[model samples]
Target: MAAMKSTLSDAARQVAANALQNTLVDLLGLSLIGKQIHWNVVGSRFRSVHLQLDELVTEVREAADQVAERAATLGVPPDGCPATIASAIALPVPQADWVRDDEAIEIVTEALHIAATRLRKRIEATENSDPVTQDLLISVTAELEKQHWMFASGHAAHAQ
Candidate 1:
């Protein structure tokens, strides 16, 4: 059997792999939560929130693919299996069968906050080990932060 070799030193590859794997888990988990709320959301703001959820899911899914490919580029296999994500994901699971639009916004905002926070840490982790991977993480973090702000601001608008 042949093995993929990474150009990075062992330590650098390890660091990049850890950051990429964790980021993949978070991205996948966020997409799942976004879709859940997309389907279950109800209220005056349902249409807008549903559409926004699709946007969020699309962004995260693309980010996940990039992270996974980055990991493979580093010769580290990305584990995005349901079982792996189930065990590693840190995002809160939605408990309600039907969530109000306001509540959905709050939930999604909170999830994005968690994802962005972890992504910031991953960004820091990869900065010294791999600048190329670090750049990707930075871009992903920016998008997650944007989504977080939008959801949070939407909730505030509804509260007004």
Candidate 2:
């Protein structure tokens, strides 16, 4: 008879590491994009738009922290260094041309949508391996989806 191989599910660890790396990369892009817009925001809506953009940067930074900590908890080195993240992240190159609320929303929504999709895949990978990790991904993904939905809804309404 063939001997059965022993196995332990560490899929969660893999998911955590992947997510942490991706999050930091996206966060770096998010920070630059948000700050660029914040500094150059113009028009009569400056105050309101500035405040909202600041909140978004704050939220993305928080998510980065959570993902990094989770990676450490899983005994993996957190994958981030400013230069490396900048180079590795697959975000749109920071553009300083968009000066409208809808423009800002479009850029941010696209980036966050990418991040959210990545997280959803991570959630699936970890779901059967670890409920804790799956729950974490789901929670984070939900927040990203909320932002995406807001952006998408605005576009839809405007188009109609």
Flag regions of model 2 displaced more than 4 Å.
1-12, 154-160
TM-score of each: 0.96, 0.78
Error of 2 at 129 (Å): 3.1
Model 2 steric clash pairs: none
Q: Please list all clashing residue pairs in model 1, or write none if there are none.
A: none
Per-residue CA lDDT of model 1 for 100-125, tens digit only, reads 88889988998999999999998998
Clash count for each candidate, listed in order shown? 0, 0
lDDT of 1 at 110: 89
